[model samples]
Target: MPPDPHADELRSPPEPFSSRRPTWDDVGRVADLLAAAERTRTGVVATRAEDVRVRWLMLDGLEDVVLVEEPGPEPVLVGVGEYSTELDLLDEATVVHVEGQVHPAATGRGIATHLLDLAETRARSAAAEEGAETAIVRTTVIDGDDRARAWFSTRGFVPVRHLLTMRLSLDEPPRPPTWPEGITTRRFRPGRDEVRAWTAHSAAFADVPTHFPLTLEEWVEDRILRDPAFDPSLTQLACDPDGEVVGLAFCRAGVEGAPEEGWVRDLGVVPAWRGRGLGMALLLDALGTFRTRGLTGAALDVDDVTIGPAVRLYERAGLRIVRRIDVVERLTSTG
Candidate 1:
């Protein structure tokens, strides 16, 4: 058989690294870039392929939101950035969330700046279309990453919130959960529990900082149903004797990179149920679920700056502060 003439073109080196819109084909390359960046900082590839894929699919503008840098023949991705304008779902304000990762080796080349510029332009344009009263661009930085924090600070981003990422080792069995009087727990009922769980979560975070109520549709689409990692068996809900959902511990199991870790994506107790141990019981139940699934540990995040006791509650439940993250925002509009 003769070698195909097009075979060389297929194996040919790629063009010089440049920024361009991403496609489904870029998911793997983008995941690699994110994983490499994660390993440099945390010694782990926390950003899994599923995370990238699901996030890309969930964002408001799939095509305009993503940018990647392909460097060399092998087409190794060195940078990723996404601009999202879905904050209108949280409020009428035009707020865009800008998130991205840059390869550690690719720093100081103006890549980050260029990405931010592109994101801001996209965000502002989206905001204008929405006729928003105000436009804001937001991003987060790990508290310990001085370089990242400085980079954003130099670009006029102001820190607005401090989030604590907590972790608990399951090597030691968690204390027996003591449910409050008249409260009972069970795994979520797939179709029936969606709205109920959403209600419980919204009520739980209502008093927290920057509280934005998510509509039932938004709640189901973004946080619950769309995630491939969501596990109803691991999601514990506390209900009253009459069957009212008073608390919840929504778990996300089988995260791509951290297979042995279960994420307590949302753990909360309704206002009336606070201080009755409902939250603690719900959290312990989630941990037990993880343990039953043979996970090594569990993790969750809280806005410690705003909800001090929420952090205390997790600490008392045996979770320690593994890291800190800063939420920063910049106004894209002059007025």
Candidate 2:
């Protein structure tokens, strides 16, 4: 099988290494690798697939060694890559980001540690070119993936925020709320314009400390080009009398796994849109959609300390945290 079209195309001058871009042929094998390594503790199927695609970059470069299991009667897990990565500045600041995968079979080896170090050096160099002061590398470990989290902490990252995987059983009818006076909610049918909706989303979320301002092209690419990100019928939007998209709830499903589960990649009712019960209404609508699709449950991840008391709301709705994970940042040399 050929590599996936979405995999990065490597164009470096000839070197001793050989890299093969991961194709669709690699997806099933990669999926097996993830299961065997127990690398991912809990995640939406779509999100996991995205990670698989991102990791293909190291393979295409070939310079990064791959320890994949020999494809035969019984495949085994091996590690991938040793690529050094560095800074990619956003606007004027140097940024540190890492996207790589592990061979589930090779869990105890310090492969991830080595990759992170190489990437950190690249990040520092990238920051230097941009005249930025600091950079931070990031990764996630499932609550069950204790060893991985310890590995990250040993290298300097700390637990900053805890994310909870919450689920709402969709077997029953959702009791949606009635919006407050002058505020109304509706579904965002496919093919309609979402520019203003995006604008509202941007304005409402402008205060989030470290979010990137995505261009319209990027938004389109994210929601449209991404196959698993489709299914607009599952989206609900809240609007005011002036027709502003102040609140939004979007749900997507996993193709590789359970079809009976609808995952909420995001559900936010802008601050201005809050207090009117729009959040609950949007959530109810999403749950209804999931139920309509015959899904047994609806899932979403929320920050334990979000701007609003989201955890409380989920608890009230009969949803409980199924998994817990943390994201930490090492404050750069702040003067």
TM-score for each of the candidates: 0.76, 0.68
In model 2, the Cα lDDT at residue 261 comes to 83
lDDT of each: 0.76, 0.61
Could you tell me which 10 consecutive residues in candidate 2 have the lowest summed lDDT?
A: 9-18
* lDDT for model 2: 0.61
Residue-level lDDT of model 2, residues 158-204, one tens digit each, is 87677888877776778866666777766666557468657766775
- Candidate 2 regions exceeding 4 Å error are 1-33, 37-65, 68-76, 81-112, 121-135, 189-192, 213-228, 253-259, 304-308, 328-335
Off by over 4 Å in 1: 1-17, 23-32, 35-45, 48-51, 60-62, 65-78, 89-91, 189-203, 214-232, 240-244, 305-307
Screening candidate 1 with a backbone cut-off below 3 angstroms (N, C-alpha, C), the clashing residue pairs are: 14-73
Query: Which candidate has the top score in TM-score?
Result: 1
lDDT of 1 by residue, 275-309 (tens): 88888888888888788889999988787544588
Against the true structure, candidate 2 reaches a TM-score of 0.68
